[model samples]
Target: ARATVRNARALAQALHDRGFDVLAADLGFTRSHTLAVRVEREGGGESVAQRLAAVGVIANKNLLPGDTSPKHPGGIRIGTPEVTRLGMGEREMVRVAEILDDLLHRGKPPEAVAAEVAELKAGFTTLRYCFAAGEAAYRYYDLVGRDPP
Candidate 1:
């Protein structure tokens, strides 16, 4: 739990440093694992979310305060819990920001960015913050019905 909080702060800082306008910066960015960033300059939240998703970085399009339309929100809400659970830390957050910058700002192709994401994810396949270590984060669908040996 403590580690998650620390990682979240680091991730938020990393994103902010990479020129993403973090909402509520006056409030220390965030108290929880979630960080909301205003991406209206690069593109609206939904558009940016789509672009990030294309490159395997998932984030949500969110409606900032005073904004009404869900279809065209003003912010992208990101969280670090999943990555934290995957054993990523502050340094990894910086790497993620670089990938995002390359994709969104430098016009890198989705395939290229996705390869980078995959390479980063390769080392953190086991789940953390759970009851057991060495457990696979994802289940093979074909093996779902089989019992563990």
Candidate 2:
């Protein structure tokens, strides 16, 4: 609870530091992953993820209708998973936000982005996504007469 309060305060400070217009947060999720950020858009120059990163907040932006990238829309989806995998704590999550922001908004080349993606993946390789495992999980669920696993 103490850590949550601290992080919350830091997030608020960070948003204020970045000049976000509105910065309300969600509290239902057990972790920061559920947080949402809204910033005043400026002539296609400002973006939600950029604001969050300025304040060291990592978040996911939902795809605009029909958009289909891990990042879309104007939302930043952040969580503790990657930090935990990187052997980091809450503070590191804040730092990770910097890396995320740079990659997303800077329009860095795909190869450079892919390399960072690989590092992040290496941190949590267990869920690296395996086709065989997916098929098996699907089969198990199907055996129980469930929808696609």
Candidate 3:
């Protein structure tokens, strides 16, 4: 939980540094909810996630209005522990951190993220037993599966 919070804070700070108005708030009124981010915009062209990503924030869709815990909610949690297990160093962690912000904020199209997710799965050579690659694929799958348009 601490690690997740740290990741969230780091992501928020990165976004703020990159010219993004970061919203530091909890979402969903549940124990296992999540932290949320709302990237303020002007013309309203990009999706909230996309706008946030443009700067560096990765807003989890599960986040409602006030929640914390990635175990089973909207907050997308990123932890360095897994990368560390995979033999990734600080620099790699930073890069993965950047990727987290990108994956969340980019509001990647289902197809695009899906492709990325596939590549990520293929890259999971460490059998280090992490969840990001798989979770990413599942999330993208769910998103694509629920496409209403």
By lDDT, the best candidate is 1
TM-score of 1: 0.88
Candidate 3 to native Cα RMSD, angstroms? 9.9
lDDT of 3 by residue, 59-100 (tens): 433443444543334333223444334344434434444554
Q: Give the TM-score comparing model 2 with the true structure, all chains together.
A: 0.39
Across residues 56-138, which tens digit of lDDT does each residue of candidate 2 receive? 34555543333344333544334443334333445544444444445444555546655664565444323223344323223
lDDT of each: 0.83, 0.42, 0.41
Q: Write the per-residue lDDT of candidate 1 for residues 11-127, one digit (tens) a residue.
A: 778778888888877778888888888888879899999998887889999999867787889998898888888788888988888898888778888899999999999898788
Q: Report the error of model 1 at residue 86, Å.
A: 1.1
**All candidates' TM-scores?**
0.88, 0.39, 0.35
- Rank all candidate structures by their lDDT, best first, as comma-separated numbers: 1, 2, 3
Clashing pairs in 3: 26-65, 26-66, 26-67, 27-65, 27-66, 27-67, 28-65, 34-67, 34-68, 62-74
Which lDDT value does model 1 have at 10? 77
